[model samples]
Target chain A: MEKSLVINPDKCTGCLQCEMACSYENEGVFNPAKSRIKVFTFHQEGRFVPYTCTQCSEAWCQQACPVDAISLNLVTGAKEVNESSCVGCKVCTISCPFGTINYNQSSGKVIKCDLCGGDPKCASACPTQAITYVDADQTGLDKMRQWATQTDNATSNTASNA
Target chain B: MHYIIIGAGPSGVIASENIRKLDQNAQITLIKGHKEPPYSRMAIPYFLEEKITEDGTHIRHKSNSFNEQGITLVNELVSEVKTKDNTLVLSDGSELVYDKLLVSTGAIATSPPIEGINSNHVYNCWTLEDARNIAKKAIPGSSLVLMGAGFIGCIILESLLKRGVNLTVVEMGDRMVPRMMDESAGGLLKSWCESKGVRILTSEQVISISEAKAKPLQVNLKNSDPLSADLVICATGVKSNTGFLESSDIKLDQGILVNEFLQTNIENVYASGDVAQGLDFSDQSWSIQAIQPTAVEHGRIAAINMVENNSCVHHGSINMNILDTMGLISTSFGQWMGVEGGEESVLLDEQNFRYLNLQFKGEHLVGISSLGHTQHIGVVRGLIRGKVKLGVWKERLMNDPTRLMEAYIANI
Candidate 1:
């Protein structure tokens, strides 16, 4: 079965290990600026949200790519940027609704998450288990299970009170 | 069913692909006028900058992509569209019949009418051939005078600089990118480019270009001294390619007119990309948005309507322009000029080359223009495109325009 990277923002500690791992895996650096996965800090609310390419089946970046540089990797189901073909026009960056794809000024090419060719470094590097790779068909399975267990406990508590 | 798509630009290619997806047995023919592989003209700047090779500009990297997809690639120009006959007369004296026809011939660069503008050493950076010619003549330390400071001009500004040319930009407007930027924002862009060693002459016009003994070409100005340069690159503007449809029944305006379904007056004829003037989302007006996103949207919608019989209606496209001049990033979205009687909130930091102007109509955010700030700015586009009601956040934004992210999350 195909696997997908699932993110649980509630479990995130905002240590940026995922960012470092992603940058090193893709760009060979520990710089968050170069990382494809970004953690946005909501300073006022004390919240951190990690965001990256969701690998949309109908990706705007893929469709709007002037040179057709973005293509789907069948094995990983990841939209990969062929750097050799990319002209670095930044059209993909602008076309992406989530702003996940960005221009690499140094290489003169656009960069995005490639799921590390099926073994995502961000998922592997998460210290808090906030990011995990699971079956693509069951991305919401864990959340559903958690809610189901809570409902069962509440129903049992009500029965005992009655 | 046979689908004939003229022009192998983004619109035609995407439409063909989408059609192939929807109809497995449909025969798709993509006619490209140029001899080169289907390539993007927008990638010409990158080609000129030596970031990628000429092959890198091909719309599809694989040589046999169209063939593999069962799409026939025709290398001939359409001379006329016979709407009555449901046929296209190509330049090579050949006629092709089609059940449905899509006109996506795109736009051509237009040079201002001036004497000797076509003289040697003057070129338009429009096509791959133009980029090749520019790359040869734009050697390091070469003197190049670029005319016009519009969107196209500013796009190639950095590429020209990176080539190490002693460059001078002459714009007829009072400041840079006047069509997309306001006076204050445009003025700020001018100063930023000037600081990067570009000689900018605003409110200046090139009267004529003549051959000179001292230089390759002499560019005469309307108000100032003539400038001598090794090359003169014109980036004035572009006009839609609708000459082929002059005699046809296809409606015409500044471009070929299409309705909400991207269909012309003719039932089987459709138009998309820069060639089709359709609906504008911000003001519900009809206009041409010569951008890639709009082209992609139009292609998909038109192709869907072609196969599914008016199954899709184009809601219209937002007017968005993003530019990176030198190292500064600037963007304008929707009705950035602001409607009359609309409220505006502006934040200008000339010292840091940062500026933000938000235009609000009553409780809704309608438009925005920003420079030098890139973090979470996509929310600004989301707000404008979503037409979110700002309510009390309008006053909060007026107090501090930097709170756009907060305003967007709260409202959207």
Candidate 2:
């Protein structure tokens, strides 16, 4: 089964380990600005949300690429940007509704999450288990189990009352 | 079903691939007016900048991507579309029939009527061939004069400057990017480019181009002294490539008229890309948004309707333009030009080269134009596109327009 990166924002602790790992793995640096995955800090809400490319099957960034520089990595299910082919017109950055894909000024190419070619560093670097590599078909399994356990306790409490 | 898609542009190529994905047995044929393999015109500037080769501009990295998808590629100019018979006449006197058709011929750059404008030294930088010729002439230390300072002109400005050419830009408008930017923003851009060593002539018209003995060409201006240059590039404007459909029954206004499904008046016929003027999101009016994102969306939506007949409806596209002039980045979204009675909040730091203008329609953010500010900027688009109601945040934003990301996070 194809694996995917599943993110649980509730488990996040505002630590930027994922961003550093992503940048170090992909760009050979520890700069958060150069990282493909970004952790947005909601100061007022005191919540940190880690966001990156969702790797949509019908990706807007892939379609918006004028030179077909963005292509699917069948093994990783990641939309990889071919640096040699990309003309860096910045159209993909605009087409992406989530705004995960961004242009790199140094290389004149757009950068996005490629799941580290199937060995994602961000998920492994996430200390809080907020980001995980799970089965593509079962990304919501953990959430479903949590809900099921809650409902089971509620049902047992009613039965005891009866 | 036999699907014929005219024009091998981004719209046509994407639609063909999508049609094949939806219906495996459908026969998809993509026709092209140019001899080159399916390539993107937007990448031509990079080609002129020597950043990418000709092969890098191909829409599909694999040359046989079309063939692999079982789509036929034809190089022929479409003469006419016979809607009644579901047939098309090619320029080579060949007639082809299709069960469904999509016209996405895109647009062609227009040149102003000036003497010697069609000369060998002058080019329009619109096609790969034009890029090839420009690459040869726009050499280091060469003198080049570029006409027009609109969106297209500004886009190629960096490329031309990168070639180490002594560049001069002439614009008829008082400021650069007149259509996209307000006077303040445009004027700031003009100063920015001027500071970067580009001789920009505003409120000037190119009277004519004449061959001179001292230089390869002499560019005469209506109000200023004539300038000599080795080459001249006209980035004036572009018009839809709808000439072939003049005799056909396909309706044409500013472009081919299509409904919400991107289908033409004739059943089973559709249009997309620069050739289609469908719907606008901001005003809910029909207009041609000749941008790449819209073209890609149109292609996918049009293909879906073609395969699954009226299964999808286009929600219209926003008018957006992002331009990188020299190192400065500027973006405009939705109705950048404020509507009547709409309030506007502007923050201009001319000395720092940072500018932001937000146009608000009541409590909703309708439009935005910004320069040098790029953090979480996508939220600006989301706020305008989602039509988020700002309520009290409107006053907060008016007082501090830089708090857009905060307003977007709270409201959207």
Candidate 3:
């Protein structure tokens, strides 16, 4: 099964360590502007959403890319930009529904979260477990188990059709 | 099989790589018009701003990437193509033959005809050579006069501002990026730049430029006072580099003519990138969408047809341009200039520098131009490109365009 980055925005602290780790891992820099993953702070609601590419199965970015620069990683299920193939057109950046893919002015290329080539640095760098790299097929397993534990096992509330 | 790809720009290089992947035993030779190692022209601004090194402008970082993949890199210009002989005649008096050919020569920066415009201080920021020359003199406190404020000019303007130069942008058009953005949108950008301390002169013409030995040159404008500047950069526009093809049998219209398959009139000969006049999906028109993404799409579509024996067909391309001027983001998509008999909706907030304009034909959204509101940039394009039926959402959008995300989710 392909691995994926499962994000729980509620656990996010907005410390921005993930942003630093991402930029350093991919761009060899500590600049937050260069980070593929971004943390959006909703000041009024006191909430923070750490967002990046969701690696959609039918990704519009991969389909809309003119040069086919975006490709699906079989192991990580992350969409990777072949920098050499990308023309810095910003089409894929605009095509993505999440707006996670962004154009890097320094490199003149669009960048998105590539899950750090299977071992994502953002997940390891997160102190609050807000971002986790896990098996994609079982991402809902934990939620299903939680709901299962809350069920009233001893009560049968079914109506009989006599 | 042998493949001869002309022009080492993104389109040609990507096509060559894709072709090689499909057919490993095929002989591939990529001919570049310049000496650079497949560097991106888009990265030149970053190089000018000192954000990236010269090496960083190169698309591939690996050493001898082409050679390792058995793709020959020929740094030479194709002076002529003998279609009947199935061969290419290079400028160095060499002949190369191939089973398939791709022309992706891209474009050349156009210099307006003016007196002493070719002086030492004048430059065109379209190539690596131009970037290197401008970076040396675009220093802090240096006075620079930039001609034209179109797409390329606006991008270079941002870099020049970062260099701390006293920049003056003179545009012949009434507003900046006249071709890309509408009047109000371009006007807003001009004000935004002016607030950032850059001087903008619109609806103006540069009469003449007199060269100087080592001092500042005199730049005379038609409707303004004469000014002296340390350097003058021309960002007038670009034309397709299809001059060599003038003698060839290929059909040309502003650019080389290609069908939906991206094939030229001649069989086994294809064209992509800025040099090809492909389809515009917005209205099924034939035009040169010279932007980088269009070039990439043309390259991939052409490569698929070449490898699959003309089995693949292109669905056409949408004209899209996204510009980040200083910190402000502006975008235009599809028929942004508006189609005939189309209903239009606009929302402008000059104080906040936020604007959105949507064009509609019946229930389908056709064109969009926006500035500052970038949260859901994809929805407009998706709805327009997908040609999704809006239904009641159209009425809701006509009321307020900010509900684009809600519309996209409900429709798609």
Candidate 4:
């Protein structure tokens, strides 16, 4: 029962609705800063990339979180942050490579993505299927086809040249 | 399959009704993460100034009307999304499985990285809760320190100044809303703000903030200086809520990237609202502006594409601005600032405060910005969005704005 969000940067228009959904789901308000999932805009490249806690089987934010504020939810396979236990020290914020976990200064708590338990708000709010909650194991299917298209281009280019 | 939509904001509620209209047999359940019904985010500054009440800012007509249409309104949060089994785990431990899913999760305020930003007086006005808290503490003649003098900052200053809030707006940038207006307009706006007693600090970066008990928040400046204020607010910007999304297979970048169809890589998942950055008509790019109109439009477009795919959806291809502050009403659509094609013609009467600036690329109207005039505003928007030629309106645009549209429609 592994659940994960599949993000396609090509389709992403970078609206921040996913971030809004994540924050509203966990924080009881429509706040993007409080959202566990983060969307980063690559302005120079004319692209938008939304990233969140990948909820890796080997979670760094979870292990780095002091007082065990972050824990893996078995039902949805999401690493959730317990605000009451979170000290807002931002230890996990530093320890995680992606920097998904953040400290809420107002609430004096640490927040990260919890997969909305399992029905992620980001995936729901996305007007484009840029972000989707899908089978973790089969996430690479799109990439496989994408590369496969690239692979076919070689023969087509060679044929056109001939 | 019963549909449960969460966070009855503009995105969630509109999505519900659109879904119902498309597939009437589908049972819908809408959940609100907050106590109040969905409201417009853009009208907030006006509401705070007593120009309009909370109802005046509502994006939804009759929120409770959803229940009459056989939609369940759940006043709670959806604790989890169990993607493996395809079910929603609510705060009450309730679960809902849907045939399709739409996430209208909006954005949050990103508090700037300043010193002592957690003081009791520091605030960010992105939520009803934040607004209420700031309002409770906002008193006449209360000194205010606002970080990031962007569009929101200027509007907030204009609105709050009328009510006697001693305000000082600090921006890291050299000009205000550099993305929207050109350098000249910014200089004019800077003078306007200063004339209104709104202290403007440009090219000044707030390093950190010290304690604010008896004195104002001691803001350590980029230079070896410090400013003090009783209340400090960070309007720097915001980041998206893609946290729990890590576990899911949703593709994300500045936001969840959906295609023209507004469908995620996954089978039945869709994203919209502030968090979803679609297309930018202004720069022919992809960026998300945390404006309330874009959120509602994104939700509507996404919901339509979700159920039916008859029409194409564009994350706007141009950058646009339409705002009215005090007696000033101005709008600029498309790239009017420094694009090479347009020849600039401005009618500026400082004494009368009747300013109309038009930049023309050949005979068509490329961009327009004005003060004390309300004609050709919608016509410009329609032209920019439609890329229609302004053969008829060009001769009489500077003369009159209201009739400009009629003439253009007839000629074209």
Candidate 5:
């Protein structure tokens, strides 16, 4: 199975280290604005959601790209934007549900998280473990395991009553 | 086979690349009018904002990319083409012969006729040279006045804002992006930009600009008071570079007319990008689609037919445009402007500033326009391009247009 970048928003501290690392990794710059992965802050709710491209199965950005500028990486499961092919139309930026794919005006191309060509810098740079790269099929395993633990307690109570 | 491509813009470059890909031994020559590398005109705004260096605008990143692919790059402006002889005369007193020719000279920004419009401070954000001039003068806090509020103007607005200019936009139309959006959508966008601290003047025209020495130029408006600005940008519009072909025997109507195969009237000669008036998918009519996607598609199809003897056929180009202004997103696809006798469904949320307009010609969606609704926007393009049979979902969509995602899922 291909690997995916799993984001845990609850653990996000909004330190923006992942953004810095991501920009540095991909662009050789430390500017957060250049980073593909973004962290959204809900000040009133006191929540920070670190978000990036999910490398969606359907991949609207890939489909909407008229020139086939976007392609799927089989190994990483990341929707990669081919800079050579991209024409900076900004259509994919609109098609992206999460708005993860963006037009880079400087390069005249659409840019998104490519999972660092298989090794995501955002996952490693995250200090709070807010982001991690794991098996795509098992992305829901952690949540499933949490619910399974609650079932165990319920089962014990019924056994004791019997 | 010697293949010559005029205009080293995205279309010409892409076509040349494809031609070389199809036949490795073929002689490919790219004629660029400018001295710099082939760059996208869309990147000029970002360049003005200093978001990227000039070199970043290059379509190809690798050094000597053309030479690496064995494509010869010539720097010369093509003055004339002899279709019968399949030869072109360059401005530098040189002639080149080609077996097949692709004219993709693109377009030039139109400078509105106004007094002092040619002043040193006045600029158009069209080419890399124009971007350089604007960047050099558009210093932080410098007073800048933009002359148009169409799609291109709005795009440049964001970059100018990021540069911290005391920006003001003057539009002759009632609302911004008058060509792309309806009143409600354009109005919401105007308000959104106003909230973001952009001064907008609608239904106004710049009567004239007075040249001054060592002082801000005076900008006289049709309705409002005169304003002073250090720089004036003319985002008015663009005209195709077909003026050069007036002497040629090839057909011209606003732009170089091309058939569905992107072939011009003359045999073995073609045009693409802003220079070509290609077919519109919504209606079987020819129109100039100056957008980048259409240009790229035109280039690919033109190249394939040029090299492989009709290996590919171009159906038509969908009129599509998406603009991001100061973080506000707006999109228009196909015939965003409703056709005659078309049934329309509109969902307008004025409070939240979200709007959706869908135009249906019978069971198929011919056009769609939206604001602030980013998710699944591409589905509209899919539905329109695929011409999917919506069946009962068409009626359901007419009742509730927000079920677009559902309809797309069930149909496409």
Candidate 6:
């Protein structure tokens, strides 16, 4: 029943509005440089992708944080970072495979997406539903349905063709 | 020793976070030159209208969370980088070693070359500090001379007019945003700004800026008349912040040259934000741009690539910018269609501020420019993504941007 942010690259306008929203929600400023969610742009291809920590069930950042600052929220399944306990060693940054954990040299700590403590404004602020907070377990439902419809599109061969 | 980010702007910040999720043990350090925490560079103007506070635009009010994640944050201007030795010399004569580096120094606003352009009242609205300095002098009834009539300049004019500043906009080009949008769009925007109590003068060439403090400062233009001003804001254009890279071997034309991975010629060194530029992933090897989204995406891709064990994913940035003038959404994506993509056609809705121009090399949607709010941008975006059959949606796209949703396909 856990909710997660869904990103539809097709809908992304490459505006970085979601990034600003993320930074504002967590950092109290509109700096996209501090946002947890990111949107990638492929200029020549005219494509944009919004990316962030998927908040995996088996979270690597939670396990790698030696100072015990990284923990998971039971209610929302978010891998939250405890700022007070962090040592700024950046061990969790390397242990996690996706590169979602990062260090802020100004405060000497790591930062990432916490899903805005559950509501995730990135989904709400998106003018286009490129980023949406959806059911974590059924995250693949959209992709599955698209593929399912394609299965119905391919034409069956007639017996005479053999 | 896992990642070394050169700039603390949006791209470096987001990329570092992305890398951390993949590898928690990696050490990530972001170096920023600005005195305050990273804030939205675009929202600096909104702050002028008191729409948001200094704290309101801050990108990271809380850096402790990163400290908990074991990331190091450095707040100093990087003077030099020894990629040969993998070290960075800081402003305070300190040095930090790195296994990898990502640069997102961002772009610098173009300063008009007019004599005494550096005078007290001359303004540039690129940074928070710049905006703050301009705000101090923008008192009610102040006569302001705005140089340039582009998007930022236009927004500044609109925002300041609301404060009752007697404003005048001067542009060297025939129209605003001439480099990006066509003359048609620029003319439309100029007329729109004029309707809001701002004087618009095109084809203006600046000769000098002198002291006229007793009244308003005189902006002597190459044209017959001079623009008078108590305050002057320049929004001519922006140049990539690659002057420092001149000392290094990194390639630079208009900006720092990088590849699809956002990596520079110097190994283990990557750049993004304003200072970095590279070939477009979808077009010619022309310089990409200094836009924010592209920069952040470049940082993420570069961070992933810098981590060798699990090769991080990276992508290139196509030039795209959307202008939100408070509520009026002006979207410009892909090529102008008329510029590089080939023959172009148009669907104009002057009454609705909606104009959809379709550029095609026959059947593909190579470029599109929607002048007004059209929800079907998603569909247009999909076609631009190189999905099949752009012609199928041209008639429909002309009708509505929302139809793009129905035009989308899993494969396309």
lDDT score for residue B101 of model 3: 95
Q: Write the per-residue lDDT of candidate 4 for residues B70-177, one digit (tens) a residue.
A: 877777666666666767777778777876677766676787655677877788877766766667666788777888877667667756776677888888889876
Kindly give the stretch of ten consecutive residues in candidate 2 chain B with the minimal lDDT sum.
B373-382
lDDT, candidate 1, B58-128, per-residue tens = 88888899999999999999999999999999999999999999999999999999999988899998888
Residues B29-127 of candidate 3: C-alpha lDDT, one tens digit per residue: 999988888977866776787766787677555658889888999999999999999999999998999999999999999988998798878999899
The best candidate by DockQ is 2
Candidate 4: misplaced stretches above 4 Å? A1-162, B61-63, B77-84, B89-94, B282-284, B309-312, B315-318, B338-344, B349-366, B392-407, B410-412
Give candidate 4's error at residue A143 in angstroms.
48
DockQ for candidate 4, please give it: 0.01
DockQ of each candidate's interface versus the true one? 0.20, 0.21, 0.10, 0.01, 0.06, 0.04
Error of 6 at A82 (Å): 22
Candidate 3 structure quality by residue, lDDT tens digits, A1-162: 777788787999999999999999999999887888878775546877777767755354664564446777776767788886665656676655445677776776778888888999999999999999888776864432232222211011111000
| Per-residue lDDT of candidate 4, residues A17-134 (tens digit) | 9888877787788987677666656444686767666665435455433233467688887778766445443445433324456556566456667777788889999999999988
Q: Write the per-residue lDDT of candidate 6 for residues B1-412, one digit (tens) a residue.
A: 6577766666666667766765678888877787777665655655787755776555444657567667677888888877788888888999989888787777778886669788877878988888888888888888888888776776566468767788887888898767556766666666666666678888977789887757658888887687678888888888877666667667777778777666778877877666777655346465746554455446545656666532533334445555544234455555654555366666666555565666665556556665664332433433554334665555554555444444443233
| Predictions in order: lDDT | 0.83, 0.85, 0.80, 0.63, 0.80, 0.65
Instruction: Please tell me how candidate 4 rates in CAPRI terms.
Output: incorrect
Q: What TM-score does model 2 achieve against the real structure?
A: 0.92
Fraction of native Cα contacts reproduced by each candidate: 0.33, 0.35, 0.13, 0.00, 0.08, 0.00
What TM-scores do the predictions have?
0.91, 0.92, 0.82, 0.65, 0.78, 0.72
Per-residue accuracy of model 2 over B327-352 as CA lDDT, tens digit each: 78888888989898999999999998
Off by over 4 Å in 3: A4-74, A80-91, A95-100, A103-162, B212-214
Candidates sorted by DockQ, descending order?
2, 1, 3, 5, 6, 4
Docking class for model 6 is incorrect
| Candidate numbers, best TM-score first, in rank order | 2, 1, 3, 5, 6, 4
**Which model, 1 or 6, shows the larger TM-score?**
1
